[model samples]
Target: MIGKRYTVPVITLAATRRDVYGKALAKSRTEGLLPVVVYGRKEQSASYFVALPDFKKVYREAGESSVISLKTPEGALDVLIHETGKDPITGEFIHADFYAVEKGKALRVSAPIVWVGEAPAIKLGGIVVKVLHELEVEAFPQDLPHEISVDLAGLETLESQISVKDLAIPAQVKIIAEPDDIVAAVAVAKEEEEAPVMDISQIEVEKRGKQEEEGAGTPEQGDQTSSP
Candidate 1:
């Protein structure tokens, strides 16, 4: 995560029915915002709200691998987005789930895959293949890693393969994944030619989006995660 952090101030709002929540939620989402409820280990009810754009900025800073500070009127608390809702048409953010955290606690998060170095196979006109774009790991929120990088220049042929066991890790990071997991590998080289255009009779526009994913609850893990 190479971006600056953003602090969002949340206000308490009670929407008893879906009708009320819908109207408030719609208005919040329309202004690039969302409603969130924070329930932690203490079972505290911190029903709050936040702006989508503000959440995005901090989420980017934490790189999705670590926890961030959630600033509220009461005080500042560490947190991570457990879930978020996005607009279907504009593909913008709406509401998000904020999970409480502490730096001293152990947590698990996924790290993004980073391809480093130009492979000899790539320069040899081989098609570079990317696999295992993200990985799940457990660690302290403060110790969460931004990404895991694998150097491809060492690969001499298509037979070369890099597995999760071969991944380089910092001393502070512990490996908790299976060693046999394939991180990336080189495929046989392919040749590329100029663009070939064809007449299109049918075109279907599809929205690119993702569903909110929860952590299935935090467990003791020691793996790295991705960039913001």
Candidate 2:
């Protein structure tokens, strides 16, 4: 599903001012500014306010792995979305943490899996399941992918499976997950066997027969009273 595209998308967000806290932070959000922090290896952590709309646009595409060009009054910084916080009730974007990454340094990041095409096994009544959804990878900021495409076309039979080794990744990126890790697979659904039905009348007869057998092996009540 992954193919080389000539055009690379440019994601940018402008940071306008310093930290906005308490009532001021709430006021900034009401005014459409999102409070964010940018920091990374060998870089000083700094707080800035970004436009909510602009950040949403970049986040939709860049996610947390892709490099985002953060424009500040000081200069442009290449950063990654380290973490994000959202409102629990409304699910609104509340806060964000961006990591400033060095140009050529390798960093560990998680990339989401994107499934493409339909598995042939699924057409034949086999269930297709994604065993792994995200892949941990080590790569330079520029080499990171927004999402790794996993082609379901490889699953031709019920026993077919896709592993990390089968993924098509760029040479510059290194997958942190084991090569034997399964990405997707197809399995034949087993038909559930119906439980055996019990014969109530036959069970009652058996109970009676057992009672009669025990009674025959025992002495009468009068004979037992004389012995006592």
Q: Which prediction has the highest TM-score against the true structure?
A: 2
Candidate 2 structure lDDT = 0.86
Candidate 2 minimal-lDDT segment of 10 residues = 1-10
Candidate 2: residue 158 Cα off by (Å): 0.9
Q: Which regions in candidate 2 have their CA more than 4 angstroms from the true location? A: 1-8, 204-228
lDDT of 1 by residue, 1-228 (tens): 122233324322222112236666666556654677775785476666666566667666556666666666677777766776776997766666667776587878888877888878766556667778888877666656767777887676767777777777655565567888777777874467879775453322121111112333446588889789
Candidate 1 ranges with C-alpha deviation above 4 Å: 1-20, 189-228
Q: List the residue pairs that clash in candidate 2.
A: none
What does candidate 2 score on TM? 0.84
RMSD of each: 27.4, 3.8
lDDT of 2 by residue, 21-139 (tens): 77778888888888998898878988899989988888989988898989998999999999999989989898999999998788889999999998999888999989988999887
